[model samples]
Target chain A: MWDFIVERRSQLLINGFNHVYLVFLAVVFATIIAVAIAILVTRLPKLEPVANAVSAIGLTIPSFALIGLLIPVSKIGDGTAIIAVTFYAVLPILRNAVVGLQGVSPTLLESAKGMGMSEFTSLYKVRIPMAWPVILAGIRVSTQMSMGIAAIAAYVLGPGLGTFIFTGLTGYGGANAFNNVFVATVAIIVLALILDLLLIILGRLTISKGIRVA
Target chain B: MADVATAPNAQADARERTGRKRGPKLDAEQLIELFGIPLIVVVGFVAFAIWRNTATLDSVETNALPWNSIWIQLREHVVLTAVGAMITVVIAVPLGIALTRPGLKRAAPVVVGVANAGQAAPAIGLIVLLAIWFGFGFWTAIVALVLYAVLPVLRNTIVGLQAVDPTLVEAGRGIGMSNLMVLRRIELPLALPVIMSGVRTALVLLVGTAALATFINGGGLGGLLNTGITLFRFPVIVAAAVLIALLALLIEWLGQVLELVFRPKGI
Candidate 1:
């Protein structure tokens, strides 16, 4: 592993960066859409079940299969991979976002309205801020999920550390196969950890102490 | 982590959504909203299939698609899901129960953290790592799948067992029941629903993750998808995807049935 890392340091760095980039992009897309849908669902409670079910059913689509479906349309590489991964990442975040937003007390919103706040203002100032921790949790889940799915995106020639894994599989029984996979796997694990920790720090910095304590 | 906690809650949401036992007849708007999206997807797929009927799809006879090979692959896929889920339950339930015990209370965070890490890391990376270490085959895939699916079960078990009413356990003890008896007779029964929900999640996850087994040289439905991609056979890719999706839904349904069967009296 050490020799492999030393020899492929530059390649590993580039791939690792690519890997994080893919996850970051997917999570960003998922968070934005999920939170938006969550806000919409909160307005129309009857649609909650429909929204949640769609995401749940979406989870049933295998990553490999979804990537295959996208190949012809997205033409592989980053575009197809990112689209498929973003789809999968949407569920956990969307589910959590809906739960978080709905979890905000009705009375609290009513009081904001009582104080002459507009609907959008209450949503922006009261509901979302209060729901930050849970929404952040959703983003964290999306990050972890997309990290794994992004690796599988290698099948479509996606840019990521998965290139090493696929290459190693192709070269199995050779001298460097094990080393290649080992290094890539370790790198992915490390990336996951670092990303998770960063989210923790982000949560601390962004979430107010009142919500943090609660 | 909150994600782990959310697993059971998500399951509950699913159940609540679909398991409305004697609700009023569906209204027009509700009916359209519920079935509309799926109808669009089915229509879209059929349209695309018709539009893309190249000479390859036409000249390629029905037998040319290798149904037997696909079935064999699907069987292996099922094997992967079953073995992975069984191993996960055997290991996670006990470890989870142990963690909730008084003696192990302080160790819960560390243990849960390790379990969370297993899930946090890329599952494809886990499979490839196992393949590298153990060599590629059924066992390697099973091991990787187990690692990836274990977190929900463990976390759910801990949550379930901890959420059990303390007074029930106290009553069991008051009846001269030993710790083991109380746990078996009282705690386990109450926690069973939550634990079972976790198992269901794990099983569904295993089914999906098993698709990656093909990458490790372990044959499964994923092989069909990969082959389809290699050969530019859109039908084959769509077929494999449809089958996998069906299988996932089947397993999730089976899990719900199991939950219903195992559910204690009335809530």
Candidate 2:
């Protein structure tokens, strides 16, 4: 294992970075889209159930199935992977953002209005800030989920450490098969932890002191 | 992670604890799921059947896209999911109970924290590694699936039991009930909803993971996917994808119904 690591250190680092980068970009895009849709759901209460149903049904669909469906239209490679990862990434954050924004007290909105804030301003300043921690929690979950989804998306020739696992499988009887699988799996786990810790730090920096939870 | 299904249970808990104005609202959400899922399943099945009948298949597609083979794959997927889930519940719930007991209670957080960290590892990576270690087959796939799913059930079991009102447990003991009696009569019933919700989440996770079983020759609808992609058969690919999605949706709906039907009322 040590020899394997020494020989493939740069290759391992590149794959690991691509995996993290892939998930990170998808999660960021997902957070934005989900939060915006969540804001819409908050504004139009009727859209709430529709949003809920979509997210609930959405999460249940297998990533493998989605990848299969995507191939004819999207062809193979990073686009399919990104689209699939972002799709799964959206559901958790969407659910969380809706919950987070709704959990923001109506009274706070009323007070913001009383202070002469517009609806947009109230959302921008008061509601979103109050909801930031919960949304961030959603982002963390989204990031974790996206990590797994991106790995699966790699089956489509997508960029990631997931390629190593598949390679390890195809070379099942080879001497380095276990090493390949073990190294990629461990690297993905480590990256997920680092991302989660980073999200916690983000929470510390972004969340309002008054609303922040220990 | 909430895994989507747990969100409703959390809502239910909030409603129970806070007496929130959420009544009838969730009924509508449930109604959408209840009515909508089966409809989509039927539609997808019909559409796929029509497409399968109408579409011209090449020799490779003809061999790979038979109805009997599809049924077998579907059965394999379900069996893999169901067996894996049953094993997970059997292992996770009891272990959860043991961990929450007085002597082992301190280990709860330690276990959950470890499991949470472990969950971040990709499912395919785990499956591949396990296959390499144990040799690929149905049981290896099942083991990987169980390991992947056990965390949600275990965490939920612990959380559900812990969330039970202590005063109620004391009240049962105060009335001269034995520890086992109190657990059966008081704690388990109250925690049933939360626990079932977790199981539902696990069930959904299992179904999704089982689709990947084809990778290891464990047999499932994923073979259609694997075959399609390698063969570049678009018809087989679309049918497999649709069927898998429909099956997952149907299972998810069943899980929600199970949560409603099995959760003891009068909580």
Candidate 3:
């Protein structure tokens, strides 16, 4: 294992970086899209159940299946991988964002209206800010989930350390096979922990003092 | 309805949520979920069937598209999910109950913390590592699936049991119910909803992860996908993916049904 590390030190670093980068990129896009759709659902209200049901169904589809399903259309590349990661990433966040935005107390919104705040202003100044904590929670979940899904997406030639796992699988009986998969697995676990810690810190720095859980 | 004039949407949202918690008693939203999932699966399978029956296939596609092999793979996948979930429940629920008991109460969070950390490992990585260690096969996949799924059930079981009202347990004891009786008759029923929800989640997780079992020669619809991808056969890949997705949906639907059926009557 030590020699294996020495042999592929730079390649390991690049794969690890790519893994984080892919998940991070997909998560950012998912958060934005989910939040926007959540806002719309909240505004319509009738769309709530539909949105919930859609998310439930969406989340049910396995990442493996989704990656395969997309291959025909997206043709087995980073596009398919990113799309699949973003697809899964969106659901938990969308559900949370919907709940978060709707969780803004009705009285508070009315108060914002009484203060001469416009609809947009109230949503911007009150609704979203108030919902930030829950949305951030969703983002955290999405980020973590995306990390795993992105690993699987590597089967489709997606950028990531998952290549090591697949590579290890291909050479199953070889001396370095276990170490290869082991390194990717450990690297992914470490990355996931680091990202989760970062999200917690982000929540700390961003959550309003008034609503801080302590 | 009267309050709707004042707070139409939130009132509806609250009612919707409450209706869901109240369980599948003909509520519109619940009914939609109850029926909508199966409807999607039915339609998906129909499409898959039509394509499978009619599509012109190359020699590679023809070789991969046999019904016998597909059925075998499907059976393997379902068995992996079902058995893995059953074992997970057996182990996780009992352990969870033990943890919440007085003797093991303090260990609950520590166990949950460790399980949560274990979850950070990617599913594919875990499966591959385990396969390498255990050697590739169905049992290896089952073990991987069990490890991946146990945390949710365990966590939910502890949380659910802890949430049971202590006074109710005391009441049972006050009436000469033994500790075990209080647990069986009072606590488990009250906690069933939460625990069952966790079980449902674990079931779904098992379905998803079981697809990865094909990597270790565990034999599932993923074999079709592996064949398709490696052979560059589009039909095979799509069929495999869709079938796997459909199976997952069906399992999710079955889980919801079980959760409703096993729910203690009064609660």
Candidate 4:
């Protein structure tokens, strides 16, 4: 593995960058949509269950199937891949965001209002800030999920390290098959770990000191 | 004439009372979900079936459409999911229960952290990694699925066992029941719902991940997906996706029914 990485340093770096880029786009798309929907449903209350159920069903569809379904509409490329990954990312982040928003104490909201803060201001300043940790946790979940699913995006010709795995599998007994797949696998795992650690740091730095749990 | 006036007031009062009682409850929406999911599967499958019967794809080089090859892949998918779920339940449940015990308490965070890492990592990476190690087949797929699905079951099991009413366990012990006896008689029963939810989550996860098995020639509905994608056959790809979604929803429905069966009586 070390030898393979050394030999293919430039190629690996490009694939690694693609993997991160694909995941980054998908996560950002999912977080925006999920957070928006979560906030909307939280206010509506009655729609919360509907939103949850839909996301649950969305979550059940395999990454392979989703990419396949999107192929016709989006055509085989990064477009289809990003859309599928975004679909998968939406569920966890949406669920977590909803939970986080709902978890905010009612008394806290009341207190914000007592201070004469506008509803929107209180939501922005008090509610969302308090809900940030759980929402971040959701984004972290979405990031990890999208990283894996992004590999499947290779089916649609989406850029990622998954190209190596698929190519290795398709070329089974050929030379360098094992090395290609192995390196890609290692790269993906490393990426997942690094991303997770980044999120952990982001969580710590963003969350206020008084509210920080050990 | 007087009855008309009184009737209008009565109707208004009843409407106000019911509206107040309903408040923000989403009972109607929940009912729709209860009924709507199955309705979707039925409608979607019926539509797909019609398309399969009428829609001809001369560009297709693969086997007949989705249904013709579906049974083969469906069997593989179901068996793979079942075996994976069984392994997850067998391992995760016990470990989850054990972690709640006195001796293993300190190991909980470490075990959970490792499990979290497993879940957080890309699933395809894990599946392919295992395929390389085990030489690509059904068992390899099962192992991969098991590893991916275990976390939810394990996490839920721990949470479930820990959340069980402590008083019930203490009462069981006070009656001279052994620790194992208390766990079995009191704790497990109370934790059953949570454990079941975990199992359901794992099953749904396994069902989804099992699709990736086709990447390693493990053979499932994903074969259709991969072939359809490769050939750019629109009908085949969409039909396969619809079927896979239906299968997942049906399994989740089955899990819900199983939950009802396992649920303790009298609250």
Candidate 5:
């Protein structure tokens, strides 16, 4: 097993990096889009429900199915994988953003408006600051969920730690198949933990102290 | 006529005083509009995919759709996961209750942290390890699914039970109910909705992950997915994807119905 790890270390590293890249890119893209949609919907009463429902339905579709559906439309590989991950990631962030924004005290929002702040300014300065903790929690959940789903993207020939997993399964009778599975499992867990911790730290640093208190 | 006039005026005054008027909690038509269109589109897409896959269905002589094989696969998947979900709830709910005890609060986070690790562990990897140790097939899949599902169930159960009104429990005790009786009659009923939500979430997730069981040749929709991939058959792939998505939606809808049926009156 040790010999196997030493020999396959480079392949594992590349696969691991690919996995991280896909997840990170997806989360970052989804966060921006979700927050934007959340903000827009909050401004329009008629659009809010539409936006919310879209996000909810998006969440219900299985990630694998989403990827599979995309395969024909988009070329299979990292791009399709990233697109599917992004779709999956969007719902959590968007839902949380809406919830977090709505959660802010109406009085505070009115006060900001009374002070003649623009909608954008009030959002960035007050609502988002107040809602940061909840938003971060959503991001944390999305990050973890996406990471796992991204591994399954290997079936589509998408790169990542999933390679080791799929390869191990395919070569089940091979001598080092067990080692590949073990390494991949450990790598996925480690990656998830590290990402989770990083998000926690990011939350602590960015979220207002006042938001943390509640 | 005089009383009616006065009531209308009073209601108008109330509405003027309050920015929002009391009305139905959710607008049913609006909900239908919001959710209905997207659901239709999704369902339509699935139908189109199935129709497109008809030739592939013919190739197999079994409806090119692989119905029997799919059913057999789905049964094995569902049985393993159902048992796993049962185990998860059985173990997790009790552990969750125990963790909420005063003496255990200090250790709760650590225990939950370990469970979170279980959540983070890749399902394929977990299955692989279990297979290595247990020698493949159904038991290994169940063990992995249980580990994957336990944290949500445990956490939600604890949260729901804890959220129950303590005063109510005290009231039950005051009425001469024993500890077990109070828990069984009062706490469980109150916590049922929240606990069911967690179970619903876990169920959906389990169904999704169970597709990975194809890796072990354990059969299910995953086999459909795998065969589709190997044969370069787009129709087969689409068929599998549609079935899996429909299955997920069905489970979600069933859960919603169950929750409604079981929810306490006046809650």
Candidate 6:
């Protein structure tokens, strides 16, 4: 077992890094888009329902189907995988952003307005700061969810930790297949734990003390 | 945070408005607009997919499309998901209840933390490890699916049960019901909606993730997806994708129907 681990250490690291890269890029992009849409919908009350409806529908579509759909237009690769993962990650982030913002008291918003703060200023300076905890909660959910889904993207030939998983599947019957898979699984799980811990810590740091206590 | 800042103001407003009638019930038209537009868009996408695939139906015979293969595949998928979902419910509901117990608050996060780690572990990775340990096929897939599905069900069950009114539980206790009786007769029923929402979410997620079973030779719609990719048959791919999405929507709709039929009166 020690020999096996030593031999496969590089492969394990590669797989781990690949998984992280895909998940990170997907979450970052999804966060940006979700925040943008959240801002847009909150600014225009009429679009709130529309934005929410779209997010709901987006959530309903399965990850495989989303990736499969992209294959026709984008071809199968990391690019398609990233797009699918991003799409999958969007709803939680968007929902959380909306929830966090809407959760803020109307009076505070009104006070900011009364004080002549610009809408953008009120959003960045007041709404977002106040909403950070809720928003981070969403991010925590999305990060974990995306990490799992992103690992599966390897089946589509997207580069990630899933490679070992798929290779393990195909190489079933071989002596090293089990070892490869075991290593990969441990690596993925460890990576996921690290990411979750990081997010929790980030959530603690960014969210207000009162909110954290709550 | 804003709520803390604005509570005094809201209290003043609340007092002033105490004599006024509440606004009209949520508008049906607006509700329709909220849910309908996206439903239409998704349906449109599905229709387009069906049309595109059907246009090629003449060139390929039905027998060649792996219809027989789908039955074998679906059996594995369904069995795995059903079994996994059952295991998840079994473990999660009990754990959820225990966590909400008065003495267990400190340990609740630990349980949830472990479950969160389970959720974070990729389906592929979990499936792979199980396949290695359990030697692949049905049981491995089931284990993977269970781990994947457990967090939502457990979390929701805890939240739902926690949200139940403490007064109601006290009332049950006052009326001479034992703890188990109160739980079964009162708490479970009250928490059913939220718990079911979690179950619904788990079901949908399981259906999607079950596709990964193909990687482990466990079989499912994933077989169709894999075969399509390998054979470069776009129709097969589209068909599998469409069927999976439709199944998710169908299940969600069924959940909605169940919710309506079972919802307590005057809720």
- How much lDDT does each candidate structure score? 0.75, 0.82, 0.83, 0.75, 0.70, 0.69
Please estimate how well model 3 matches the true structure, expressed as its whole-model Cα lDDT: 0.83
Lowest lDDT block of 10, candidate 5 chain A: A52-61
Candidate 3 lDDT over residue span B144-212, tens digit each: 989888887897799889989889988999999998999898988899987887788788888888889
Name the candidate that leads on lDDT: 3
Could you say which candidate leads in DockQ? 2
- When summed lDDT is taken over every stretch of 10 residues in candidate 4 chain B, the lowest stretch is B3-12
Q: In angstroms, how far off is A121's CA in candidate 5? A: 2.9
RMSD of each: 4.8, 3.6, 5.6, 10.4, 9.7, 7.2
Q: State what share of the real interface contacts each candidate retains.
A: 0.43, 0.62, 0.58, 0.44, 0.36, 0.42
TM-score per candidate, chains pooled: 0.87, 0.94, 0.94, 0.88, 0.85, 0.83
Q: Per-residue lDDT for A1-214 in model 4, tens only?
A: 6787799899889989999998888888988998899899878987876776676667667778778778889988889988988887777778667767877899999999999999899888887888787777777767766777888788678999999887877777777778887888778877877887788888889986767777
Error of 2 at A91 (Å): 0.8
- Each prediction's interface RMSD? 5.4, 5.7, 9.1, 16.3, 15.0, 10.9
Better of 2 and 5 by lDDT: 2
lDDT of 6 by residue, B1-267 (tens): 221111110001111111111123433323543456447547865685566556656444344354466667767777766777788889888889988887897787788666655555566777778887787676778777777777777876887788899999999999999999999988988888777766766776677777778767777777777776776667667766766666555544444455445555545
> Per-prediction DockQ, in order?
0.43, 0.53, 0.39, 0.23, 0.26, 0.32
Screening candidate 3 with a backbone cut-off below 3 angstroms (N, C-alpha, C), the clashing residue pairs are: none
Give me the chain B TM-score of candidate 3: 0.90
- The per-residue C-alpha lDDT of model 3 at residue B130 equals 96
Two-way DockQ contest, 1 vs 3, winner: 1
lDDT of 4 by residue, B123-174 (tens): 6767777777788888888888887777777876887788888888889989
| Clash counts for the predictions, in order | 0, 0, 0, 0, 3, 0
**Regions more than 4 Å wrong, model 1:** B1-64, B101-106
Ranking by DockQ: 2, 1, 3, 6, 5, 4
C-alpha displacement of B245 in model 5, angstroms?
0.5
Error of 6 at A94 (Å): 0.5
